[model samples]
Target: SQQGEEDPQALSIQEGENATMNCSYKTSINNLQWYRQNSGRGLVHLILIRSNEREKHSGRLRVTLDTSKKSSSLLITASRAADTASYFCATDLLQGAQKLVFGQGTRLTINP
Candidate 1:
């Protein structure tokens, strides 16, 4: 599968803590995007980093990409219970245009 692999698969943390997830892809990519999905809901775009970028941030979210390692990570600081959801990393391959391959996802549970 072109889909990447996310580490930990699942994580549980208390509110106000930080949560981190890692994703490793098999091929070179044009860009990487992080998404969040609550139960029974559609995916919400969190952040995106281009191949040329090493890191990007959005509010409480921070994303870092390492093209040489074909990997990326997502960090959510001061997580809240509302942050409980599934996070997925999607990659836009350099060769495959107009297509995104998504990881299996990392399930995050933030307890109050």
Candidate 2:
């Protein structure tokens, strides 16, 4: 299983500041994906970086992958109060086929 673990179980930041988090995975994977969850709601995919790729960006979100270390980092620039949510990193494992394994997640709070 290509499961990942996230660091800094929790974080607190004010609006306009950037929030960064890291994710580490075990075993080789096909791709890595980042997601955001608002409270108890469902998760929304923020970005995806393939194993062959090093980095990717979407709006204020930036993601970097280091396959040599089996880890990845996510940075949210100029965060807002609405960005307060739980962020998760998932890895796509291809064992003959494909499946996604999610990490524990990082809980972030953006204070006004």
Candidate 3:
């Protein structure tokens, strides 16, 4: 399975702090995407970095990928209370249908 697993099931941070999480996958992938879900709301795409890429950043979010190790990390810097959400890593399999398989996810809470 190309599915990925994210570490730190939950995280809490004070406003203006940083939050980091990790994800590990089992197989090769075309690309990996990070998404954020606010409670019951649908996920919102944060960023996507291809397998060939080492790192990418957007706004306050930064993502790093290591294909050799089949793992990735996400960092949210200077987080705000509005940044509190569940984060997930999704990998697009190279061989199968182009669909994203999500990780277990890391729930983040930013206290104001």
* Top candidate by TM-score: 1
Clashing pairs in 2: none
Candidate 3, residue 90: Cα displacement in angstroms equals 0.2
Candidate 3 residue-wise lDDT at 71: 95
lDDT of 3 at 88: 96
Model 1: per-residue lDDT, tens digit, 1-112? 6468998799999999999999999988999999999999999999999999999999999999999999999999999999999999999989887989999999999999
For model 3, residues 1-112, the per-residue Cα lDDT tens digits are 5389999999998999889999999889999999999998999999999999999999888999999999999999999989889999999988869589999899999999
Model 2, 46-82: lDDT tens digits are 9999999999999999999999999999999999999
Residue 101, model 3: lDDT of 96
Model 3, runs deviating above 4 Å: none
Whole-model Cα lDDT of every candidate shown, in order: 0.94, 0.92, 0.93
Instruction: Give the count of colliding residue pairs in each prediction.
Output: 0, 0, 0
Better of 1 and 3 by TM-score: 1
Considering lDDT, which of the candidate structures 1 and 3 is the better prediction for this target? 1
**Candidate of highest lDDT:** 1
- lDDT score for residue 76 of model 2: 94
Any idea what lDDT model 3 has? Answer: 0.93
